[model samples]
Target: MSLTLQDVKRVATLARIAVNDEEAATYQQHLNGIFGLIAEMQAVDTTGIEPMSHAQDLSQRLRDDVVTESNQRDKFQAIAPQVAGGLYLVPQVIE
Candidate 1:
């Protein structure tokens, strides 16, 4: 779709961007080019085309799920100012 100078200015204002007359014209051209490309892409017929996750036919290698670190909950809770029933207690801020 073609964009006029006013359209560019309106878009810039909505986006909270400061664009001069020259910049607006440049942006209008760039946006129009992008829209043209989008239009061209939309014109293509992709009937019965299967969607693909990746271009390459490859399977992801996954590592074995195993616990590496030992439990340090008691050690961490020991240093806390206030901890009850294995839970940290914070002061109530709201009434």
Candidate 2:
């Protein structure tokens, strides 16, 4: 998984990046080092290992679902600007 200056330049062009010659050379070496590290990681064997989402096996405690509502329709609707037949009224927008 070695990367060259030409490969770096192509990648930069595909990503819409403007890289100079000097920066391309520097980025080529840096990318090569990163690929080398990834290759090293690939050499390790991970047999019979289970994927984990979190480090601790903690359960999520949730509150119980219950119907608890305040039935104060008349008291709340009293502050509306306009009300007719026990309902709030608003401006009609459509023609």
> Per-residue CA lDDT of candidate 2, range 1-95, in tens?
89878889999999999999999999988888999999998888888878789998888999889869979899878988999999899999998
Please list the residue runs of candidate 1 whose C-alpha ends up more than 4 Å from where it truly belongs after superposition.
62-95
- Best-fitting candidate, scored by lDDT: 1
Worst 10 residues of 1 by lDDT: 49-58
lDDT of each: 0.95, 0.91
Native-structure RMSD, model 2: 3.2
lDDT of 1 by residue, 1-95 (tens): 79999999998999999999999999989999999999999999988988789998799899999999999999999999999999999999999
Off by over 4 Å in 2: 70-95
User: How does candidate 2 fare on TM-score?
Assistant: 0.62
Model 1, residue pairs in steric clash: none
| TM-scores for all predictions | 0.63, 0.62
